[model samples]
Target: MAQTHTVTIPHFVTEASVELTHLTAAYAMYGTPHIQPDGRSNILLVEHALTGDHQVDQWWGPEIVGPEGVFRTDQYCVLSINTLGGCMGTTGPGSIAPDGQAYGSRFPALTIRDLVHFEAAVLDELGIREVAAVIGGSMGGAKALEWTLLYPQRVRAALVLAVSARASAWQIGIQKAQMTAITRDPHYLNGDYYHTEHTPQQGLAAARKIAHLTYRGELEMDERFGTDAQTGENPLGPTLADSGRFAVESYLDHQASKLVERFDAGSYMILTEALNRHDIGRGRGGLNKALASSTVPTFICGVDTDILYPYHQQEHLARNLGNLIGMAKITSPCGHDAFLTETRQLVQIMHRFITRIST
Candidate 1:
């Protein structure tokens, strides 16, 4: 088990100018921290995706974080913070407000940069001036890239796998569809369903289903399901009005149900909005200006079969990053989540990346 830690933010004003106070950040540390006399060590910040928490080993698997893993806790002090506006131990919509009620829908709009700022705050409390590297995938990948631009001096290397420089219209449309699924649910109650009999289960589930569709890919679905009906359910024999579910539909339902059981719907919306608003160049000018200005050595990796955040998106990043090490490819049929699934392959690529940059 990893050691857990918490840091308090006395006060903060977001980029959007929303004021907050007494916020708490929940995080976990792996391996023995080697804080030097100057109060800094070899810190490797391992970030999590939208629905992930601070427990890196559990969700990411041994191929990523463990005694013999590529991260090598023996080599660097690994830190993983539960996302700020997340349903995990970190403070978010369900956290208590000054009035002692849940923040609920009143949770301030948080940006990807804000997430990096909060991570910086936590490092400040720990007296760490810099980190050896920042690594993550999906939303986590976005945070890793943000760290380089937002706090370049503090990060030595950034590894952003399976992410875009900014939110694309296609990505936003998919997110919007999920947002609609939850907000339009009769039980949503404008995101104030806590302690109420009415819960937005259906809506949240619908949102997850929509998201799962994007998380996977066309080839994956076709190969795995391919018009086959789920066991014991006959879509062909059933009446048209209440047809049985297809194998793919059943798969999506499973994914939705799992998320609903563990994650808060309010948090889902907030984080989705954050992803929708992600842009490295938001205030720095534009994509070209932002990527060109940052001198951080950013390494990008992409899954060839990922349709949600296609290989083209990463190709664009490689061509544009100001100080790119190079681009690595993880060939898998697992779609966008392949970055998480193909840990061994990722470890090999990263191993090479570190070696090349070292020489």
Candidate 2:
């Protein structure tokens, strides 16, 4: 297991012009950074998804971040930092403001660029001159792309998996609905529920259920659950509310309950909204123009069964990236989550791609 660390940024500003007096960034590092006199090493910056913490090993699993993982400490320094609006030991809605109270609903809106800015701050503090590669899947993928576009000089290559250059309308709609589920919860109390004994866990759980449906593939769900009720439970018990849950329902319930335990509803809303605002082209001209500006080498991967991001999005990226290292696909029925679960496929791609980039 990797240990996490924290750094307090003296001052920070958001793209929307919101200035934060202080920002605490949580991070984890593995292996020696650089041995050369210049004090720079081949660094692998692994970003996490929406609800992920700095402890990438916890969510990314061992195959990727373990001691003997792909980006092993023995060969390179692996760095991970929690996003700005993250709640896992980072400054977020739950963080206390200079006024000595939790920001809660008062936390300012954030953008994907803001996340990159937070990351840059952490790197600057650590004196990391440059990174050999930046890689991630899903929301993490978005950050990887931004690093190439915003600071290509600082990154040699990047591998973005399971994400588009911009959040699609369909994705934004889903996030909006999930945000509504949280805000409408009676216990939410309009984002001021922090001090209250009752929280919007029910709302968060509902939101998670909605989100999980998109994270999984349709065929995967069908194959796993079908019309079957959870083992020993009756789907037709006469009364719907009193009836036993379907296998699919049980799966979603498990996903939702698990998220509610680890995530804050307020942070969930903020991060989802941030993803909704993710557009690499915004103010940098059109999508193609912005993409053309990223001169760094890049490789992209997609999952064929990913209904949320879809395979075509990856193709779009391949077509536009300035220096495409080639694209690979993960053949799986697990959908978007395949990026996380399909370790063997991922290892094959990284082994091929990172080997070239690092060399």
Once fitted onto the true fold, the runs of candidate 1 whose alpha carbons sit more than 4 angstroms away are 37-40, 356-359
Residues 138-162 of candidate 2 have per-residue lDDT tens digits of 9899999999988887788999999
TM-scores of the candidates are: 0.96, 0.97
The candidate maximizing lDDT is 2
lDDT of 1 by residue, 68-122 (tens): 8777777767899998889788888888889888887788888898888988988
**Per-candidate total of colliding backbone pairs:** 0, 0
- Runs in model 2 lying further than 4 Å from the true structure: 35-39
Taken over the whole model, the C-alpha lDDT of each candidate is: 0.86, 0.88
